[model samples]
Target chain A: MNRFKNNLTPYFFIMPAVILLSIFSFLPIIVSLGISFTDMNLRGLANWSTINFIGFDNFVQLFQDKVFLKSMGNTFIYVIIGVPMAVISSFVIAYLLKLVSDWMSTTFRVIYYIPSVTNIVAIAVVWSFLYNQEYGLFNYLLSLVNLDAIPWLEDPFIAKLSLIAMAVWKSNGVSMLIFLAALQSIPKMYYEAADIDGANRWQKLFKITLPSMSFATFFVVVTTLIGWLQFFEEPFVMTNGGPLNGTNSLALFIYQEGFQYSEFGYGAAASFVLFIIIILATLLQFKLRKSEDK
Target chain B: MDLKNNFERAIVNTVLFIGGLLVSLPFVWMILSSLKNEREVLSIPPTLFPNAPTFEHYINLFTNLNFDVYLVNTLIIVFFSMVGLLLNTMAGYGFGKFQFKGKEIWFAVVLLTMMIPGQVTMIPTYLILNEAGLTNSMTGIILPGLIAAFNIFLIRQFMVTIPDDLIEAARLDGAGELYIFFKLIIPLAKPILAVQVILTFIGSWNSFLWPLIIANEERLYTLSVGLALLQDQNVSNYGLQMAGSTFMVVPVLIIFIIFQKHIVEGFNVSGIK
Candidate 1:
């Protein structure tokens, strides 16, 4: 009895978390997959009898969905452009930070980090003002420089670019800090050896710094790519996937279908598609890394 | 050599200084614009500084827009942060220190689920909550996120580094399991605990999508939801929007400033590993 009781102690410690995750995390994944096959809508939500197993119809319609296809295309564009921009800019900023005085580095790090901590709604509000067509900061500065006041968020193409720009700005700080930590972790002996060989700054950077931080770079790129793929909040708040659905993301599309339009089955199908894409992308990156290692 | 080094230092300093100002520009604009009257805010070739600073919009948010209620609702984040910290720490300690049947499997489950994007599970979670009659309540908003898998994993990673002799000695002393956890393990786990606290607080505070869905009623709205609704209702009211943004951002900025070291260190710990 005492041995049995002793074994039970670990379960007691872990029970609450297990219960929570079973309901919220594990169960939801299964339920979502189940729902994706059915024709669930507002009426279906109200009556279980109304929710019929519609087979692949939802997935079929989703592939035929122009807006959904556009959203998929837009998400790819975001990840493709935004991930590299964020990684490169953060790497540059982190490198520059290393060269500065400690006081300046600390102060600038805090300033750069403010956006990451600030709520997305607040960020959207501030950037919307900055992106305003008339009497806005960007256009006002443009006027001072004798340039055209380009519509930052007004044009469909520009709106996507605008959202990407804000996302990079908001997200750069955390990645910068990650890069900074990686930079700081490199041994000083490597740099000293390079200096003894009379290597220039560029050679040292490409040879020593970049190669050493490869794993950190990979981590940032993967995480950032995954994040941008699901990109929802910025476009949701700023444009509502608007100016002709140019900025719609798969995540936002799912939200619109599931919650806004009450087409739960269709949304679930779309979400599953997104989920598979994300997993595949991550696995593909790992494969690429492995091949490069060989 | 000295002159060249000084020149490089000067160039780096200038570049970083400009970058800092660019980063700060939007926030500065938000605060300054919030202080301006509507007319001044709309003026062409906008004024960098508010010529006539006013707090009317801020007053309006509290009195007319139910921001006070929103603020109270946001305190739910604090409540969940504390509860989540307790639950995750216990689970972490259990996984880190104790041997149990299927322990590796369960821990692997937690780690694998961490990679699943929250969006995939969001629809079913909402449906389940609706079935439980939790919709349009604070309970619904806080339930799904109460014990994050990532937090549990982070805490577990930290707690595994804690020495086994401490737990062995405490067990030999006839201390209860609960007593050992509350008294011995928690005190030693302060660094990770601090990291968990900041992460949970910032995450819960900034959370928008779940709260936006669950809190359909005005009084139940968190700050992010309430502010988003306000923006929707007042798209042209730049001053009012700026004031609302400022109010929402200031508390987080204050917390970030106070815990800057922990915040950076937390990212570093998560990133490198």
Candidate 2:
């Protein structure tokens, strides 16, 4: 009887979360999968009978759609460009920070993290000010050196770059903190041994520092890749996917299609595609991590 | 951690601080520019200092925009969602140490949900809420976030380390599970609870997409939604928007200041912020 009670004890503890997840998390995924295989819209949302099964029509249409393709390309560009830029910049910043006193390091960490925690909407608002074509800070800074005001948001390429720049700045703190902790953990003996060999600064960095942080590097890179791929909040706020559909990300496209356009089927299909990409990337990362572990 | 020479050290420090300055410039600009008039904000070469600094824009948000309503609505959603924190801890404690049928499978469900980027679940979640007649209701916004899989995992991480002997002792004293949970486990889990509260509050307070969808009525608007509405109404009004965003940014700043250590520690463990 006592053994029976213990078996049931875990059930009581796990029941609430499991039930909620079944409702909110598991049920939604199943429902979304169902929706993806059908032509569901606002009309269907009102009258369930209007929904009709359309096998792969949404997926087929998504692949052919120019805006969808552009958004997909844009998301790839962000992840590809963003991952390296964020990781390297943060690593460099943290390495420089290692040269400072403990208090100084802590102060800078606090300063850097402010943006990471700030609402993306709030920062995006500030970004509009900085990106403003007429009298924005970027143009103002350019004028100081007699350079013409480059259209930060108007030009597609520059617009995407500006978004990437914001993402790198916003996220670098996480990598910085992670890298800082990893940096501090490197055995003092390794550096002391390097000193005996008269290793120069660059030599020390290349030999001891970079090599030592392989796992931390992997963590930052993989996570950043996943994050940039789902990039939505920036474009949704700053550009609304753009002056000419340049900044559109897959997530934004999914949101616009689902909520704004009420193309529930299309949005679900697009999200599933995005889901597959993320899973593949995550799995690939795991495989790489495993190889590194061995 | 060794400094090579004065020159090299000086150069690295300067470059690092300059990068920091670049990162911080937009925020500094936001505050400085918030005080300026329309023309001053849109000037060709932006003024470092506002020629005539005014709180007029902020005044506009409170008076014309009914910023107070949004503030109260935001607070309500955040406070209600604290239930999620309690639920997460309870569920986490169970997963942490309890042995039961299908525990691994149940835990996998929690972890798997974390990997699913929110878009996949969003449409159906909305449909589910709509079916319940919760659409356009504040409860629609609060219900979806009442428990998060990531928060469950975080709590589990904290609870697993808690020696089983402590709870086992209570059980020996004829204490019920409720008594052990409320009287002992809760106090023990205060640090992780604080971490969860800060994270959940910040997340809920600043949440845009869900709130945007649910709060169709102007009266139900949260700060992020309100800021977006403010932008839509006056597209060219920089000062008004900046001053308005300060409403969202400042509370978070206050939280960050007080909970700096926990927030950073939380990020380190979670690999997210």
Candidate 3:
């Protein structure tokens, strides 16, 4: 009896999390996958008998969905532009931060980090004011420079960029902190040795800094890529994928379809597509890193 | 060499200062605009400082907008965070210390779940909640986010570093497992617990999408959702929006200021590990 009780002890400790995850996380993934193959709409949700297993029809329709395709393209544009901007800019800021005094660095770190901690809705609200075409800060500044007032979130193309800009600002702090941590972890001896060899700052940066921080860079890139792929909140709050589905993201598309339109099966299909893309992107990054190692 | 170094330092400081101002400009503007009257906010040649700052919008938020209710609703996130922390810590301690059957496999499953984005599971989760009559309720919003896989992984990583000898010694004294966990493990895991607390607090506080979806009723809406709705309803009322934004942001900013050290250190630990 004692041995049996001891054997079950670990299970007792872990059971709560296991149960929660199984219901909320694991089961949902499987169910969502199953739902993707069925014509599960609001009626189907209401009456189980109304649902039909439609096979690949939902996936087939998703491919030809213009809005879905537009969202996919917008997500790609976001990742393509936003990822590099986030990674590179944060890296540069982190490097620059390392040059400053300890107090200054800490102060600036907290300042930059303020946006990340604040609620996205609040950030969106503020940015909307800033992006307001009339009596807005951005346009007002442009006018001061004798340039024409450009629509920040009004034009479809510019709306996408505007969302990306806010996202980059909101996110840059976290990656910047990560990079700073990475930079701090590098051995001081490497730099000393480089200085002994009469290496310039650029030479040392290329030879010592970049190579040493490769893993950190990879981690940042992969995480940022995954995050940008699921870009939702900015567009949801700011544009609602506005000005002709310009800022629409795959995640937002899933939300609008599943919750708003009750197109459960279609949304699930789009979600799986995104899931596959994220897995592939992550795997490709890992593969590239491995090849680089060789 | 000293002069050159000082010159470089001056330039770096200047650039960072400018960057800092630019980064914080929105926040400053949010607060400033919240204090401005409706007309003043939309005035041409936007004023940096309100000529006669008023608390009318802030007052409006509390009185007309049900912000007091929203604030109470937002505080319920604390309950979710606390419950999640307790559950994740228990699981973490189990995974870290125990040599149970299929432990490795179960731990692997937890890590694998981390890779699956929340959106993929969102639809089915909502359906399940709706079926259970949990939708349009605070319970619905709380249930889905109760156990983050990453938190379990983080706690487990921290717990594994705890010495096994201590546990063995406590067991030799005939201390029960639950007692040992409550008495010994909880106190010792303070640092990781602190990290988890701040992370979950900020995460739950700022969470928008799930709450927005689950809470359709105004009374149940979290601050994030309420503020979003307010923004939509009052599209051109920049003052009201800013006031609402300020109310939503101030608690987080205060928490960040107080816990800045732990917040930064926590991110460093999570990012590097």
Candidate 4:
């Protein structure tokens, strides 16, 4: 009886989490998946029979859709550029911070990290103002420097790059903190050994510092890539996929299709496409980890 | 050799100081712009300091824009959601402490849900809330987000570190399961709770997408949605826009300033530890 009671206790404890998870997370995905196979539009919800089955039609349409294609392309550019910039910048910052005194280090770290901790929406608003075409601080400063006010958010190509810059500014600090911790974890013995070998700072950095942080490098890259793929907040709050829709990302595109256009079926299909891509990327990361372990 | 090392350290410090200033310039610009006259705010060379700092925009937010109403709404949602989070945490502790059949399967199911993007069920969720007549209500905002898979996973992982002997002692003292959780587990779990609460509060406070979608009434808008609208409301007024943006970030900024150490520790503790 005691043993049985022990067995029941764990289930009782986890039951609430199980219930909430089912309702909020699991139930939604299952519904989205089910709806993806059918031509379920907003108007058809009132009429049960109107929701007809359309297998892979939405997916095929998404591929052919021009805006969807552009959003996908923008998302790739964001990941490729934004992730590396954030990672390398943070690593260098963290490394430099490590050499400073404790108080100075902590103060600088806090300053760098304020953007990460502050509300993204607020940051987006401030950044949008900074990026405004006229009477904006960016352009105002440009005039002082004898340069023309390049359309930060008004031109398609410039808008995409602007979004990438905002993404890096908002996110680099968290990566900085991660890299700082990894830096601290590196054994002092290695540095001492490098010193004994008469290795200079640059040589030690390339041979010891970079190689020692391999795990952290991998973790940061994978997480940053995952985050960039789901880039929504900045574009939604700042650009709204405007200026020829150059700044629209996959996640923003999903929102646009579903909420703005009421293309629920097509939106669900696109969402799942993103879901599959994320899963495949995650799996590839895991495969790399497995091989490294071997 | 010592002189050379000191020289190198000085260079590193100088580089870091410059980098830190560049990183923080946007925030400094926002705060200064908020206090500046409108013309100065839009001027070329972007004055680094206000000629005459004023609180006109902050005053306007409360008097004309009903900023208080949104603040109250944000407070209401955050408070109630925290209450619900307490319940969820207790449930998480129970799951981690006790053993039962189907445990692995249920936990796996929870993990699986975390992988799915929130966009998938957003429409259905809106539909469900609308059908339940909860749209435009604070319940619409708080209820859906009260419990999270990530929070449960976080709390449970922390709980697993608690030794079993403590629970046995509480049981021997005739303490009820709920009593032990409330009395013992909670006190010990303060560190994790601090991290979770800060993370949860920041997340809810900054949540724009879901709130923008569900909240129809301007009065019910959180700071995030309110700041977004401030852009349109004060379209040409960069001063007011900066003021509103600065306002939106103040609470989070204060919290982060106070808890900087824990905030960094929170990230490291959650993952790398």
Candidate 5:
């Protein structure tokens, strides 16, 4: 009995958390999986009797859907552009800041991170003002250079680029600090050894710093990829996927389908597509990491 | 060589200073524009300083837009989220210190769940909440987010660092499991928990998409959702939107300032993926 009770103790401690995860995390996965194959919409959602389990119909339709295709293309663009922007810029900033004095670096880190923690709605609002056509700051600066005031959000392509620019600003802070931590962990002797060997900045950077930073690079790349694939909040607030669905992302498409248009089945299918992509990427990362360790 | 090094250092410092200014300029503009009147905000070749700082937009956020209620609503949700932190710390402690059946498998499940992005599960969660008759309630929004896998993983990592012997001593002293968790683990895990709560506070406070969907009813809206509404209400009212943004921005800024070190550390901890 005592042994049984001792064995039961950990289960008791973890029971509530498990229950919460079941209701929110684990169960939802299964439920969404089931929902994806059925025709569950605003009308059918009310009565199970009305719901149709049209096997793979929603999944089939999602492939042929024009808006879905556009959003998929847009998400690909976001991940492609946004991920490199985050990785490369943060790498450069982190490398440069590590050269500065401690106080100065910390100050800049705080400044950059301020946007990361700020409410997204607030940042979108402030950015919308800066991106405003006639009276905005960006255009105001442009006028000083005798240039035209470009429509930042009114044009489809430009709106996508604008969102990408904001994504870089909002995300780079955390990635930079992560890179800084990676930089600090590198052994100093490598740099000193390079100095003794009379290595140039470019060679030492390529040969030493870049290799050492690979771990952090891998981390930032994977996370940023996952994040950009779900890019919603910015476009939701900024463009609402406007200018002919140009800024629509996969996650945003899912949101509008499920909530706005009440196309829950379609939304679930799109979500599963994203889910599969994320899982594959993560598994690939682990596999690569294991092989690299050898 | 010395002169070149100094020159390089100076150039880097100047570049950093300028970068810092650029990073901070939008926020400065947000606050300054918040203080200006309607006409003043839209003036071409906008002045850095407000011609006449007015409280009208701020006043309108409360009186016209019903912002105070949303602010309170945000606080309530954050409070629930923070309360759930204790529950997370408890489970984390169990996973960290206790030897049990299926320990590795259970912990693996927690880690695996992190890979499942919130998007995939979002619809099912809404359905679940709707079935529970919670769709329009604040509980619907707060319940699904009560405890995240990330929080559990982070807390478990912190709890494992507390020497096992200390917990063993407590166990030997005739203390119950609950007592050990409450008295021993809780006190020692305060720093990690503080860092987590700060992150969760910002996360919960700023979360938009969840709040927007789960609580479509205006009264149940959080401040971020309310700010979005304020934006949509007057698409071109920069002054009003900026003022509303200020209220939303200020609390987060204050908390971030107070816990900047821990906040940065929290991001670092999460990056350990």
Candidate 6:
């Protein structure tokens, strides 16, 4: 009897979370998968709306949509630029801080991490000001050196760049902290040995620091890629994917289709496509990491 | 070598000092502009000082925006979700430590859902809520969020560290599951709970996308959603927007200042960074 009760206990404990997940997470996906098969739009209901089974039509239409294509391109561009910039900058900052006094390193780490913890909306507000067209801090700084006021948000090209730059600022702190942990884990003896070999600072960094953090680097790269793929909030908050949908990410597109336009069926289809892309990207990352390790 | 290294250190220090200032420039500007009057704020070559800083905007948010409604709404949703999280933690402990049929399979299924991006299922979620007529209700706002698989995983990982013998001893004492969960398990799991609370609070606080979708009524809007609405209405009103932004930023800052150690410790536990 005791053994039976023990066997049942785990299920009993997990029951609440499992039930909630089944309702919110699992049920929604199943419903979405079902909804993807039909032309369920704002004019329709689930059971009542003569929902025709339009196999691959939605996905096909998704490819033909220029806005969807733009979203895909912008999302990739954001991910490609934002992830690497954030990872590289954070790692470099973390690596350099290691050379500073211990107290200073700790202080800088926390300070650098402040932006990471703050909300994205708040970050967007501050950065939008800095990226302001007139009397903006960034343009003012550029002006001091006789540079033209770059239309940071006004131009599509510069708008994407502005969003990406803000993304790096907002994201770098967390990656930096992760890199700091990876840095701390490296044995001092490896560096001491490099010193004996007359390895200079650059050599030591390239040889010892970078190589030792391979796992963490891989981890950061994967997660960062995943994050940047879903680049919604920054652009959504900062630019509203303006000044001509230049910064409109697929995530934002998904948001716009569903919320702004109320194209639920089409939005679900786009989102599923995005999910597939993310899955493929994650798989590729893992494959690459495995090959490098080998 | 030492002197030359010191000289290099001096150069690095100068660069980093500037870098730090550049990094924190927005925050500094945020604080400054929030205090400034309209002219001082938008002035060409903006003044560093606000001259006559006022709490008018903060006062304005409280009066006009009904920022307190959003605050209360946020608190209510976050509080219930925290209760749900407590239940989640208990379940996680049970799963991690207790023996059950299909335990690994169930755990795998739970973990699998985490990988499925929340964005993908968002439309269906809105549909579900709409069908159920829970839209514009606090229950709708907090109910879906309460289904946190990540928290379950986090708490499960934490529960594994608790010695099994203590639980066995409690079982021997004829204590029921609820008693063990409340008296023994919860007391032992405070550190992990602390981490979960801070993370969930921040997550719930900064939650924008979901709340914006479900909570159609302004009265039900959380601060993040409210801030977004404020920005949409007053796109060019940088001063008022900044004020609203400052209002949102300040509470989180206050929470961080008071519980920074716990916040960092929570991040460590959650493996967020």
Estimate every model's Cα lDDT from 0 to 1: 0.89, 0.87, 0.89, 0.81, 0.86, 0.82
DockQ values of all predictions = 0.66, 0.60, 0.69, 0.59, 0.62, 0.55
Q: Taking the tens digit of each residue's C-alpha lDDT, what string does model 1 give over B21-94?
A: 88889999999999999999999878889998999999999998999998888887668867977998899988
Root-mean-square deviation per candidate: 1.6, 2.2, 1.6, 2.3, 2.1, 2.3
Please report the candidate that would top lDDT against the real structure: 3
- Candidate order (lDDT): 3, 1, 2, 5, 6, 4
Q: Write the per-residue lDDT of candidate 5 for residues B1-273, one digit (tens) a residue.
A: 111488899998888888788888889999999999999999988988998889999999999888989989999988988877777887898898888878888888778777789899899899999899999898888888887888888888887789988887987888887788888888898788878888888888887777888986899999999998888989989999999998988888998998998767555444332
lDDT of candidate 6 over B1-273, digit per residue (tens):
111477889876776677788788888888888887767778887788788988777787889887899888878877887888877896788777877677888788788889989788899988898899888887888888886888888788888988999988998999988899989999898977886787777777777777888888988999888888887887666777788887777777677657766654345613422
Here, model 5's chain A TM-score works out at 0.95
Model 2 ranges off by over 4 Å: A1-9, A288-294, B265-273
Candidate 3 — which residues are off by over 4 angstroms?
B1-4, B266-273
Judging by DockQ against the true structure, name the best candidate: 3
lDDT of 2 by residue, B1-273 (tens): 498689887887788788779878887888888899988888876789999999999999989997899899989988877877788888998999787778899999999888788989999999999999999998898888788898889789888889989989989998888788889988998877877788888888887888898888889998998898888788999999989887788889889879988867555433322
**Candidate 3 chain B minimal-lDDT segment of 10 residues:** B264-273
For model 6, the stretches where C-alpha displacement exceeds 4 angstroms are A1-8, B1-4, B263-273
lDDT of 5: 0.86
Candidate 6 collision pairs? none
lDDT of 4 by residue, B1-273 (tens): 111577888888888888887778788889999998888887765678898899998898889887888788878878876876786687678668776667788878877876667777786676667667888887788777777877777788888899999999999998877788889999999988887788778877776777788888897798778888887667788888888888878889898888777787666433441
Residue B143, candidate 3: alpha-carbon lDDT:
85
Query: Could you tell me every candidate's TM-score relative to the true structure?
Result: 0.97, 0.95, 0.98, 0.95, 0.96, 0.95
What TM-score does candidate 6 reach? 0.95
Better of 2 and 3 by lDDT: 3
